[model samples]
Target: MLRRIEMRFLRPYLQEELKSVKMKSQIKFQIGKSGVTEGVIQSLNNAFRTRKTVRISLLQSSGRDRTKMKEIANELGDKLAGNFKHTIVGFTIIMKKTGARKPENKR
Candidate 1:
């Protein structure tokens, strides 16, 4: 009886957590020796149409330099159609589409 009551209270919370996890759709891309090419940008744009997050892995051939990775991330962010922000973790770049572009201020 006690176990059943405990489960009933926990069930709703567990379901909500699971739903949140499932809702985050992600896609992965890799940068090879060719680096960031038009094909890559096109594919990433397509992926973003359906997914909210993109995980980009920098292959060894793509160079492991942290500064290079940041540059690539910035380039990708700029080329992408919508507003995006990226975070670099080791050789991986996690880019998420931030809805609505912020208006640029002109002096």
Candidate 2:
């Protein structure tokens, strides 16, 4: 399918490979403010104009709530009408299609 992804608040240079996405309407949620994760979440909720899936990218910070990412993911999933996918690496969560493929066994 032809997908249209809107990346919000991201630094305008990060490259993402689009081979994994399976939806036609997808958006990336980027944390543009330097504050707590709650602010970011609020911003996302406030900023979301459409019901498309939103992938959030959190900014790394000291004393940040590690569980906040999970909380946000759960909240978005439960509260949003569209599909919600969360991918966490280090301290950031980028939402994407829920594609799970087990690693092939190499003998």
Candidate 3:
């Protein structure tokens, strides 16, 4: 009886988690030696306009280290300065667009 009750309550939560996993749509972008240039950032911003999630893949020929990749992710987040946030997944960087944040005053 206790097992049945637990399962009933847990089912919806498990299903909801699975639904979220399935809903995560990822767009892929490859970073080159230009190293996150204005065009790169603009493209990323454009992708965020349409999709909530993006993946940034670093290439081997670029000669960047893993730690550097992480730093790049942080830099991108700062440059974006809006709804964008980043995470490093294996060899790829994953960025997600969340609720909009207030723009920082440049002046």
| Each model's lDDT | 0.78, 0.50, 0.71
| Residues forming the 10-long window of minimal summed lDDT in candidate 2 | 1-10
Instruction: Tell me the tens digit of each residue's lDDT in model 3 across 5-39.
Output: 43355458654543463356557788877787888
Q: How does each model score on TM-score?
A: 0.70, 0.39, 0.66
Q: How many residue pairs clash in each candidate?
A: 0, 1, 0
Evaluation by TM-score, superior candidate among 1 and 3: 1
lDDT of 1 by residue, 12-91 (tens): 86545433533453467889889999999999999989887778889999988888998999999999999997766557
In Å, residue 63's CA in model 2 sits off its true spot by: 5.8
Better of 2 and 3 by lDDT: 3
The true-versus-predicted C-alpha distance at residue 57 of model 1, in Å, is 0.1
Candidate achieving the largest TM-score: 1
Clashing pairs in 2: 55-95
Model 3 poorest ten-residue lDDT run: 14-23
Model 3, position 23, has a per-residue lDDT of: 53
Pick by lDDT: which candidate is best?
Answer: 1
Considering only N, C-alpha and C atoms within 3 Å, which residue pairs clash in candidate 3? none
**Superposed model 3: Cα runs more than 4 Å off:** 1-26, 100-107
RMSD of 1: 11.3
